[model samples]
Target: MNKTCPNCGALLIKDAWETVETNDNGSYVFKSYLALKCLQRCGYYERADQNDQE
Candidate 1:
């Protein structure tokens, strides 16, 4: 799967460290292991973590 910026449809590359967060369900969630850059405009990126993969 390719990570892209929410603002712009730019491909996000793995530029930084990976971030993980634990939900209330006591399951660990992997947010993003990559950095997304917007070429046209600056925006936010939102994605859902796969519980099975985590």
Candidate 2:
């Protein structure tokens, strides 16, 4: 959808990551989020908003 860096117009790259944590009952919980980074390395990065479409 024409994703680009606001500062340099470089193409934006999507990265997904997840983490696991232990709960009080010893059950594991997982969380995940999406982030964007400038492909040209212009130091532009941001996490996708909760309502943002992938």
Candidate 3:
């Protein structure tokens, strides 16, 4: 999947992030999600904290 850069209106590349997640039932599962970013060093990267990963 391609994404548009929010800063320069250019096309961005797609990437995936994987991590373990727990549901309300207390079951743990490995999940993946798509992320988008500019390849030309547009500084459009989104920040994630340690808490956000869990």
Candidate 4:
């Protein structure tokens, strides 16, 4: 899990301690990994989204 985005200094979440699965959909987790991003409508999140596709 990441506390701040590597590309940008943005908080991934409000919680101090958070764990995220790189690929989480519905009730399934495609892969177990850590990803950090800013949800403030930036290219970073988009890039991450695209990377997830691969």
List TM-scores for all candidates, in order.
0.32, 0.54, 0.38, 0.26
Q: Summarize candidate 1's per-residue lDDT along 1-54 as a digit string, tens digits.
A: 766675566865434345788899999987554444444446453333453123
lDDT of 1: 0.53
Per-residue lDDT tens digits of candidate 2, residues 1-54? 668999999998887657699999999999988878789988787887765544
Best first by lDDT, ranked: 2, 3, 1, 4
Tens digits of per-residue lDDT, candidate 4, 1-54, equal 444555767755321223345544546334433343464535353223433433
Highest TM-score among the candidates is held by which one?
A: 2
For model 1 the local lDDT of residue 15 reads 42
lDDT of 3 by residue, 1-54 (tens): 355778987776655557798999999999776655577768675433443333
lDDT of 1 at 52: 16
Clashing residue pairs in candidate 3, if any?
none
Runs of candidate 1 with Cα error greater than 4 angstroms are 17-54
True-structure RMSD, every candidate = 7.7, 4.3, 10.1, 10.3
> What would the TM-score be for candidate 1 when compared with the true structure?
0.32
Q: Rank the candidates by TM-score, best first.
A: 2, 3, 1, 4
Query: Which candidate number maximizes lDDT?
Result: 2
